[model samples]
Target: MINAGIIGASGYTGGELMRLLLNHSEVNIVAATSRKLAGEAVTDTHRHLKGFLDLGFQNLTPEEIKSACDVVFVAVPHGTAMDIVPELLDDDVKVIDLSADYRLKTAAFEEAYAMEHRDPRDAVYGLVELHPEVAEQNFIANPGCYPTGATLAAAPLAKAGVISSVIFDSKSGITGAGINPSPVSHYPNMAENVQAYKLTTHRHVAEFVQELNRLDNSLTNISFTPHVVPSIRGILTTAHVFTKEKMDVDGVRKLYEDMYRDKPFVRVLDGSPSLGGVRGSNFCDIGFEVDERNNRIVVVSAIDNLVKGASGQAIQNMNMMCGFDETKGLWSAAAAP
Candidate 1:
């Protein structure tokens, strides 16, 4: 079994990684690291994983972690990961960064986050459905939560080279902000509100543009705006795709189906996608409809931000990098009501 280690094991994504890796047939989680929470039971921070994981959060250094683990998941925040990632990447280990550090081209990352990229190296962008090349790499940069859903919603159209312009309006749950509670997460501020922060300047736009541009570079018109709703998990993206020519409903459906037919985690459905159906699962449920009158197609996608958007996708990369079946531990149903 592959021994896995997760750095920054106190956050939402880290906890989610542990939760999913528990069932991995070829994995044994050996170390969970958190400098501040060292020696404490991992359950102290992740009460939901009370019985399944008994490992304590260790304060292991990069060398120690690399020695003990075959795969290392960097689950720290964006800026912080750049500092830790370089030390972890070497001959013996595979590192999957669940951060924005290596997801973009170094220049784009520096421009978006307004920080110098300490380690500017080539790492496969771990959007497995589109980039099947992760199976050949030692390091992967997991896609951002918003980009995962938003990009998946419009990817078929983009890849078909029929997209004239795409505008994405995404609503994500409170947990996307992370484990720390902030003003927006306050009960009174968030309970009945739909707060749209960073209307045009949200940093994740870089990732959305990066992935779509990769599919169709000449397709320049891409825009995104993000909102935070009262829910705790999942991201629902509604994409308004204006095409060069009118696409019929059957044709549009065929595009999505043909693109994702062999992809295990992307479900192309007849109707619109909803968060409830994909919560706590690695699936990205997508649906689209053509509007003949406007020469446009409306596409929607849903995914658990913690799952397909973060930790679960990280493990999916791990499976591919390790040459295991892609769905070794992740082929399961969502926790729907």
Candidate 2:
């Protein structure tokens, strides 16, 4: 079995990673690190994993991690991961970063994140469906939550080179903010309200643009807007895709079905996808319709932000990197009402 370690095991993404990895048939989680929670039971922070995991958090050094783990998952924050990942990559150990540190080109990352990238090495962007070549690399940079859904929604059209412009309006659960609490995540303000932030300049836009532009270099009118809903998980993206040439609903459906036919995690649904259908699962459910009159197609995509958007996708990359079955530990159905 592959021995794995998780860095920064106290946050939402970290906890989610632990939960998923605990059930992974081909992996054995050896070390989970958290400076603040060192010596404490992992269940203390991740109560949902109490019975499944009996391990405690450790404050292991880079040498300890390199010696004990064959693979390391960097679940720390963006700027923080850049500091830790360089040391972890010194050996032959595989590294899958669940941060934006290595997801973009060096210059684009620096500009979008507004921080200098200290270790700017090439890493496969771990959007498994779009780029399965992650199986060939030792390092992978996981895609952001918003970008995962938004990019999947429009990639077929973009690849067909029929898109004139695409606008992504995404609504995500509050958990996307992280475990930390702030005024933006406060219950009183968020409960009955829908708040839209980073209307035109969310950092994740860089990822969507980068992936789509790779498919069609002439496509430059991509725009994205992000909002926070009161729920605790999932991201639902509604993409308004305007095409250069008119296409009917059957043609659009055929495109999506053909693109996702072999991808295990992406489901091309018969109707619109919802949060409840994909909650707690590693699935990205997509549904769309064509508006013949306007020459536009509205595609909706849904995924559990903490799962498909982060940790679950991280493990998917790990599986591919390790040459194990891609669905080895991720075949469970979504939790629904």
Alpha-carbon TM-score of each model against the true structure: 0.99, 0.98
lDDT of each: 0.92, 0.93
Across 255-331, the per-residue lDDT of candidate 1 in tens digits comes to 88899999999999989989999999999999888889999898999999999999999999999999999998999
Residue pairs in candidate 2 whose N, alpha carbon or C atoms collide under 3 angstroms: none
Tell how far residue 156 is off in model 2, in angstroms: 0.5
Worst 10 residues of 2 by lDDT: 83-92
TM-score, structure 1 vs. true: 0.99
lDDT of 2 at 67: 83
The local lDDT score (0 to 100) that residue 204 gets in candidate 1 is 90
Deviating ranges (above 4 Å) for candidate 1: none
Off by over 4 Å in 2: none
Tell me how candidate 2 scores on lDDT.
0.93
Q: Name every residue pair that clashes in candidate 1.
A: none
